[model samples]
Target: MFKWASYFLCSFAVLASKGSWATLQDNNQTVCILKDAPNQCGSFCLSALDPMQTNLDAIERKQGVITSQLWALISRQDVQQKSLPSLDYELRRHTEMQEKHISHLLAVQSEMQALQKEMLHSILDVYKKLNAHQTLVQESLDKSITKEVFENRLEGVDKQLLTIGSTMAILMSRSVDQPHTVQNQSLQSPQASLQESLSEIGSEPPQFEQIGSRHFFIEHNLRLNWTMAAQRCRQIGGHLASFQNRLEFNAVTAKLLTGDVYYWIGMNDLGQEGQFVSVASGNPVAFFDWGYGEPDNLGGNHDCVDIAHAKMWDSKCADEERFICQSDNEV
Candidate 1:
């Protein structure tokens, strides 16, 4: 489009120059024709024709000189016109080159657009694939983490179970060795040995003995619970007896039979928690006996009290055990 506009401008300039040249030539030719015409009348013609004819003749002479100058201008114009085609050819060539360059630019632009579109789609696809890959990897990692936690917990449980089993095995083995161990323990602890000696000897009647102000006698098969046994002793003018001190508890413990057997004494359930009160008054008893945690209502059924001088003070009120009775008088 630009090339055509330039060509039109160049052609218009050339045509205007040619038209001006032609008009100048025609006017100069008419002036020259008059300038060359004979002045046949000469001076007479000049006088009779007035001063205007003389001026007219001088104008013609000037016109002839102008006509010669105009002819020279025309010749130069013609030569310029002959050169214009080459200039036009150069202009057209330049226009063609510009058109080619514009075409190349458009082609490159189209290719860039196409490449940009393809790149955008590829990037989107890659992003989607990356998101999917990350999701799968994260899921796998989560499962692995959960499995590890469960496995660790299971391992800890297995270790704890093993420890418990080992402990149970040791307990069972100790239980299996208990009778022999007890026989050996009889040789070590004086209390255990004395009971052993009593068991070795045949059962005999209690040689009535004084332990403090109270007197006592041992009996065979006087079966009763701790409560009833205390009642029996109370009927004889005293309560079911308590040990005056450790001396009495030890002395009585030495005479009893051993093995799955128990003995009842004069002690009763006082019901005072730490201090045993006398039943006669609610006052605290002057004496008491307890193994560690004794009188603890363990097994939820030990509200009653009894003396097992060899082992502990017990509360198996339902047991039909043998008895040891106490009275105020020497028996």
Candidate 2:
């Protein structure tokens, strides 16, 4: 019995040892590959390495994408930060300059407006004064003349008025381009119309002439003797009728100065010897064209007498002649 048991134990121990050695040998064999067995070991290694390499490559690509995105974000942030102050500064500067310019423009407009107002007021005052003077002069002349003579004088005055009208028209046209002055200028046309209306009312009824312009009725019945005529005219704001050029003389002659009766004229050798002085201007009569031997101081006592009707003699201070006055349309 003891012998059998010992043999059994020994055999069991040997079998156990053999099994352990076989397992170890199998593991070693798997670990140790033959150099020519590349198809087996190489395939195994390549498969594992390929998976690892693919994972690494994917990771690297993800990293590169992330870095590029980050850089783009950073560049955008930098540009915004740099431009913010510059854009803000430019905006502020533009706003400030605009405000200044607006203020300056307002100031200039105010000054120009004030200047225009001043000029308008001044012009209005001058126009009023001129109108008043004309009225007074016209009234005086009306009170001293014969109808025919007054009518004729009115015609002559109308001619002079035409010249003044033309001059005023020219002045207005010249000022048309000045819009700043237009406000006052616009008022003048109506004012002139009023003055003309007043003139029409004050004068005798108008008469249409064939060759020349129309004539207003004369303010006749202001007859005075020779010397008294001039004195009255002066007191009332006029003077005895004065002759200018040959044309004017002819016009007067054609109109009939005082019917057939001799009448006084405004011309006389008052200033320097042989030179005639107009009572109106108190200046030399540069336009005088006397009849033959006129103011030859002919009668020696003819200190003031001149040819009247039909080349006859009339007293210098005689109130027989109609009175006339001179004035400017504009102040």
- Against the unseen true structure, what C-alpha lDDT does each candidate score? 0.60, 0.54
Candidate 1 residue lDDT tens string, 1-331: 4334444444554555567667878877332222211242243333544566567789999999999999999999999999999999999999999999999999999999999999999999999999999999989978778877878989999999999668655543443333232234313344444434333333332345675555776656667666555544443334454565677777776778876677765443445434454443334445566767786766765555555547556465676667676655222
In candidate 2, residue 128 scores what lDDT?
100
TM-score of each: 0.32, 0.29
Tens-place lDDT per residue, model 2, 26-50, is 8774333233333434444455456
TM-score of candidate 2 on Cα atoms, chains taken together: 0.29
Best by lDDT: 1
- The global Cα lDDT (0 to 1) of model 2 is 0.54
Q: Measure candidate 2: CA RMSD.
A: 31.0
